[model samples]
Target chain A: MQIRDILSFSMHAATANRGRTLLMLLAMAIGVSSVVVLISLGDSARIYVIDQFSSLGTNLLIVLPGRSETTGGPPPLLGETPRDLTLEDAISLTRARTVRRIAPIIAGSAPVSVHNLEREMLVLGSTSEIFDIRHLDLSQGNFLPPGDPTRAEAICVIGLTGKKELFGNQPAIGRWLRIGDRRFRVIGILASPEVSLGEDLGDMVIIPVAAAQSLFNASSLFRILVEATSPEGMEQTRQSILETIRARHEGEDDITVITQDAILATFDRIFKALTLSVAGIAAISLVVAGIMIMNVMLVAISNRKTEIGLLKALGASKGQIMQLFLTESTILSSIGAAIGLVLALLGIRLAAFLFPQFPLYIAPWSPAIALAVALITGIIFGILPARRAASLEPALSLARR
Target chain B: MIHLQHIERIFLVGDEEVHALSDVSMTASDGEYIAIMGPSGSGKSSLLNIIGLLDRPDNGSYELDGIKVSELDEQQQAEIRRHKIGFVFQFFHLVPRLTAFDNIALPLMLSGIKQEERQVRVTAALAAFGLSNRAGHRPDQLSGGQRQRVAIARATIMQPSVILADEPTGNLDRSSGIEVAEILEELNRQGITLIMVTHDPDLGRRARRQILMVDGRIEHDK
Candidate 1:
């Protein structure tokens, strides 16, 4: 029989039993759309993480004291055989040709009180270049003015949440707040509405490195953020920083230098694996759907024995009978796949709308894969029932015994 | 012309062999109207099935239009069946999901005839069977006589050389059964060989030639 004729005939048979056909379609559709939606969510998470890291700065490298070779978990605290990374160590990195700039960070918690209202918040101290390096935006006044690295300027930038808590909508730009025994003028308020890697950007305070060094009563820098002059300069810049820090520390090579691309690549691998594994789990449902098709087709064969007999009596070959049944299942699955794609798209849209930061995106190959697998599974599962139908003896079937 | 020689068909019932057809040999020329009448278990339907290539005998050589048919493979036999045979059943056996038009178009569709040609043939068949206005009606919506007419139309849709009817009017009322029998007679008069299996003596006598079966053997032939 012609392909079109077979398709139409199968399609007619499928539509004839509306409830059963709808149930099968629904099962297949759920199988496909779950794979799609789950994978899209995982992909969105990957993209979001990569975006957050890229936002930290392009061609970036972070130098932390002590070595950490592990992909995740807290950085292990080793015995103090390694020398600390100081402000001088951060400044010495500027000598490398590939190193465009550096911002040494010292992080600590400090109680800042204004008008007798005190709140303890995270405080990060860095050079003025950190504003440009970390892409910080100012809602009001300028950030810390450029000056000597050791100069103890009593000035700070509070984030939006801090501003609301410390000053309560009163202008915070020029207010003075006490930070652990010293008072500092607010230099700026951080911009509204930004999140990096699930961290709210408007919930912290920034101060000059020297002022924070004295306020926190410690000198070791938390991390040194280095920017390579260009993307190609990242490797050379990492090498230079390691060598410079090693030379200053008597060639111990005690620090860990994590390139931004390496971190992003790790996250990408992790999320890709996550997406693939979840997609695999979702594929089990497709197999279930296939089995359901096989089961339903078996029942259908028995139910349509008279029709099968009629067709056989009309000179339909066993192969033709098999083809007709196979065609029916494939059509059902293909339509189900199509419906699944539409449902997944709708689900993605709803997710994107409900949680704007979730970053749900559909992978291009998902629908193609889902449809191909659905069709293949439909046929594979279709074989047994088709064979049974084809093997039916015309006389026996017509006898209805 | 059709011919059969030394046909043998056996059934296994609880490990006992029951012969359904026993060394029966028969022949009919083109356009012959033959009636096969027998009581239940006498194998009239089995004989009809073998003649229509719907069943294969254990030991037999059958020929249709001078071609060796019993020796042909399943596919080759199917091809011949597709082009050369039609079957009508007691239940009418119309696909309940399809309308009368689609029912009649089935054989043409199976033969891979294009839609336009299939439509033309089906339309003509519908009118020829006086079912033109009932083309869109499903089997359940059709009267028994109408359903039988549609079945006859479907049986002849491929324009086969021979038509086989197994108790074609068994489920119909007397008036509708007579109507159906008359349609079969009209098709036979148009030069297609008709072989019908029935237990109704009155209907059996209407055919030009008749055979009576008992205990898997022909007891009388005329």
Candidate 2:
């Protein structure tokens, strides 16, 4: 048959049962749209996690101590630790040529008061190098300078949250704050850190490392923070640092090193699995759609028995009959796929607008895959009806009416 | 030219054997106008179907244009039907979905004729049958007479050597039936062999040769 004739036949067949055709198209669109929306959401989740992790400083690594495993063999935890890193170790690491900067940190919760305004805040006591390691920016005044390592200087650098709580609508820099019966001068206010994974690092205060050590009764040990010169050299620097630290501690592999890239990879694996699971669920609906297509085609064949016989008697070959039915199925599914893709795009945009934090991004390969799936479904579901129509005997069919 | 010798067609209906055609022998020369008349279940339609290549005789030597068609495969038979034979049914089975023009153009299309030539020939055929004004109308839109004219136009559009019409006017009124018979007779005058099966003796008597069938066998021939 000519291409024009085939198309005309398909259009007539579709219009013959408009309600059924529309319903089938709607079902197919739903299936394809779900796949698009789910995949986009999965992509968005991955991007959100990666963005949150990168905001924490790409060149930094976190070191924790312990090797505890849950009874059910849960994944290993990296940050739960009882032993503290020593100031001597921190100093040695800072002096090393491979290490660009280091900081020994001590953390505690304390009540801070400024002009009758008071609130409990997380306080971090660390050396001046902590600002450089964390890429901290000063918004109001100068950071703590390394001086008088033993005696406590009555100076501190408050974060944006600490400043707001201690002196609301009032100048905080150069003001004095009381912490645990000790008076401290507000030397600087740090800029707000990037909000990541719902955690805000701008809700704390910074003080001198020596003063923190004395106040917390932590004399020799501290939490060591290290930063590499470049992200490219992070893995190599981590290996060397591990080796150095191991050798220095008599071959004790008690410290754990976690790289930013490694954490991102783990997150990628998690979201990839999530995407596949969602796609699999959507595929179930496609199977149902295929069955529906087969049923509709079969009904069409039975309804047009006399028509088929008339064509056959008029010299239509079996192949032509098969092609006609197959074309109908192809047209149905291709249109459904196109509509589904549009619906999916709309769904993504709506979801992003409703929840800005939960980004929904569509991948380029998604539409191509959807079209391929639709065509395959059409062919698979169309075969039975095509064969049935082809097998109909012209003589028997002419006698039908 | 068509010839059938010692043809036998058997049917199995739930363990009972029924002979639709038995020991049937006949010959139709080129340009010959013949009619086979019989009562219902007299094997008139079955014989026409076998001669048209729409059915295979169980045991027979069937020849069309002197080629042994009974020995040919299904594809070969279909090819012969496409190129050498035409069929017109009692119901004027014009496709309900297509216009009268498309119905007449169908045979030329099956033969793979060029589109421009097919349109020219189909237009001429419709005009010759006084269906030019109704060419664009579907079967449901046309009257019974106009529909039969379209069927006749389609049957002769390929200029086939032979036309097998089964009760061509069984569904038409008297004047329309006379018009259809006249059209077939006119085509036969142009040297196309026309074989028709009908129950009306008056229509059967109009043919150059009339054969009477009973119990799957020819009872009389003239």
Candidate 3:
């Protein structure tokens, strides 16, 4: 039989009962769209996270006071260590040649009141070099004055949210701000609505590291940010920071030195596994849809036995009979998948519009994958019914038995 | 020419074995119109099915136009059926999903005939069957006679040498039956060998030759 003939006849047969064909298409469409949407959501989350880390620069390394035991995969989610990571230890890391820039951080929460607009919010203490190391953009005014790490300067930088809440529409730069019994002048407003490490930078305030340590009456540091001279030197920089800290702590390794890629890789693995899990759940629907198609096709064969018999009497070969039946299923599945793909892309587009920061996107290959899988499953399930139709006895079928 | 020798066929209905056709031998030459008449379950339909290559005889030697068809493979037999044989069933057996034109053009399409040629031939067949106005009508939309006319058009679309028809007028009224019989007789007059199985004695009497079957055996050929 001609391929076109097989296709046209199958199209007619498949669409003959509009209700049954619609049901098959609806079931397959639901399965396919679910796979595309859910997988895209998972994939988008990974992209969002990795994008965050990359902005921190590939040569960056994070030094925390506590060591998270690395038993191969991701380290256990743990907290502060017994050993203290002091600003002195952070300063000492400059001894290594691989460490090109260091920005020591001391984090704490304090009540900041400006003109009775009192709010308890997070405060980050760091050196002037933090602007370059963390890629913080200054919207107005100048950044912190560079020079001494122990200067206890009272000047600070406020985030967009803090600036909005405290000063309303008024100018925030060069304004005095009160935090934890000490008064400081706002030197700059950090721009670009950034969120890092689960903390909205827009909701936090930053001051000189020494002023923060004195205000909190604490000598231990929160964590240190180190930027290597080049991306390739990050590993060596990690080892140098670890060694420098261990020597300072009586030859004990208590601090965890995590490279930027290490954190990015961890997030990458987590979201990939998440994507796979959701794809698996969605694939169950595809399987159920396939089985439903098989059931419907079996009924169709039973219902059209007379036609099958007639075709055989008209000299249709077994292969032609099989082709007719298979083509019906293939057409249904392909059209269903195409519809699902369009729906998913539109849904992702709408979702991206709804939650612009969610990074809603569908991978180019995901639609193709969904389509290919649907087609394969349709053909696979079609075989049994096609085979049944092909093998039907012409005489018995003609007798309508 | 069509020939059969000592054909035997049996069917197992649960635990009971029924001889559908047994020790039957028959022969008919080109352009010879013959009718097979018998009561229900007397193997008339079985004999026709065997002759049409739809059912295999257990022990028989069959030849069509001098080819040893009974010894041929299923594919070869199907090729012979496609190019040399036509079958018309009692129910008209037209595909309800297809229009008369598509139904008649089915054989042509299966033979991989081009679209333009199929159109021309199907158009000619519709006109020849007095169904030119009904070419676009589906089986359900056509009357009993019209459906049978469409079936005959489809069956002979490939211009096979022999037409095997089982109860061609069984589903029609008297006038429609006469009309259908004339169409088949007209085809036979055009030198196509016509073999028909029928329950209507009147239709049987009109054929040039007749075979009477009883109890899984041919009683006589007159």
Candidate 4:
């Protein structure tokens, strides 16, 4: 038979039973859409995290007390306590020429009250250097005054949400708020939210490191932020900070210092595998859809026995009969794949609308791979039924009603 | 010409071997109108199937138009059937999903005829069969006579040299049955060999010649 003839004939056969054909189409469509949507989900998650990480800062370094996973070997001395990441250690790191600026951090949740309107939120302590190294956006008043790193100032900066809660459109720069047990004047209100690792900048407080240490009643710094003089000096500054810390902490390197790219690479690798796995899981549904097609085809063959036998009696070769059946499934899957692609796009569009900050879009190869898989699956699963139909003896098949 | 020699067909029905045809040999020349008459289980269907090349003879050699078609492979036999033979079954085996026009065009499509030629030929067949008005109706919508007419139209659309009709009028009323019989005779008059299988005495009397089968063997040829 001509190719077009076979295709149209198969299309007619497929549409003969509307309910059955629609069920098979829906099965195939669900399988395809799930694969595309799940893969997009994983990929978008990976991209969002990478975007947030890259937006952190340029030539940035984070130092935490004690050994973190993937950083160094076990502590050199057994049964000996490692020293804390202290303010003095942060001050001493500035002695290196490759170091551009430093922000000593001491973070803890504490309630700050202004005229009895108070709620507990994250309180961050740092210096004026944090304003640039952390890419902080300030909407009002200046950040912390740059002064001696050891001086404890009675001043603080509130985030946008915190500012609203405590001041309510009232002047806040000169108001005094109580943090822990100390009274500190509101120095500035931080800007709207920025990508700051895991914390929401819109709902936190910022203060000087000494004031935070005095409020928390602790000498240990939560972490330290070090900015290199230039991109090329990143490694040099890292080495200098390490050497200086080891010399000060009795020649024992017990701190964890990490770069932005290292964490980003780790996250990228994890999400790539995750995306592939979810897509793999979704492909199983395609296999199931193919099986459903096979079952439906089997039923169709049984119902159309006389029709098949008549074709044989009319001199249709086995190969031609097989072509007709396969053509039907191919058309089915092609339509299903096209429908699924439109659905995935609409789903992604909805996601993009819901979360505008996250870049959610279709990957170029996903639809191509999905479509190829669906077509091949339809054909492969069609083989058994088509072969059965072709192998039927014309005499016996025609005997059926 | 159609020729069969020493044709035998065996069936395993519940592990008891029954010979549907045993050593059946026959021949009919071009444009011959022959009917095989027999009681139930008398092997008329088996003989028709072998003659149509729809079944393989367990032991025999059959020739058509001077070619040993029994020795041909399945594909080669199908090729011969496509261009030289046509079939009209008792049930009118028109595909239920297709309209009468599409059903008539089936054989032409199988032979890969161009669309314009197929359309023209099918249109001519519809008009000749007096079914132009029913061309768009599916088999279910067609009456017994109309369906049989569509089947005959489909069988002849390939313009084959021979027509095999198996109880072609068995499903129609008396008037429609005579109508179908007249149509088959008309095709036979046009020099297409017509071989029919029928047990009805009245229907069998209309044939130019008759063969009687008994117990898987030809009992008489007259």
Each model's backbone clash number: 0, 1, 0, 0
RMSD for each model, in Å, please? 3.1, 4.1, 3.3, 3.3
C-alpha TM-score for every candidate: 0.94, 0.88, 0.93, 0.89
The collision pairs in model 3 are none
| Range of the 10 consecutive residues with the lowest summed lDDT in candidate 3 chain A | A71-80
Fraction of real interface contacts that model 3 preserves: 0.66
lDDT of 1 by residue, B35-136 (tens): 999899999999999999989999989999999999999889888888999888899999999999999999888889999999899999999989999999
State the DockQ, from 0 to 1, for candidate 2. Answer: 0.46
Candidate that would win on DockQ: 4
TM-score of 3: 0.93
- Which of the two, 1 or 2, has more TM-score? 1
Residue pairs that clash (backbone atoms under 3 angstroms), model 2: A85-A222
What does the interface RMSD come to for each candidate? 1.4, 2.1, 1.3, 0.8
The deviation in Å at residue A10 for candidate 2 is 2.6
lDDT of 3 by residue, A214-312 (tens): 989998899999999998898888888888888899877788888888878899999999999999999999999999899999999999998898788
A1-401 per-residue lDDT for model 2 (tens digits)? 56876786677776667888897798788888888778777777878888777766657866655433333544447753434466656666655565677677778878888767788877788888777776678888899887544446878998887787668889988889987677889999888654546545577878887777766677654356678788887887778766766777776555667777888899999998998898889988888888888898898888888778777776777887788888898788878888999999998888778988665678778999899999998889999999999889887777766
Instruction: Give the lowest summed-lDDT range of ten residues in model 1 chain B.
Output: B74-83
lDDT by residue (tens digit), candidate 4, A1-401: 78889888999999989998998888898899999999989998898888888777888888888865534666456686669989999999988998889999999999888877888989998888898888888888889988897788888888998888888989898889888778988878888766467888988989899988888989999999998888788888888888999998998878888877678889999999999999999999999999999999999898888888888889999999999998888888878888888898999999899999778988878899889988998899999999999998988998776
**Candidate 4 chain A worst ten-residue window by lDDT:** A68-77
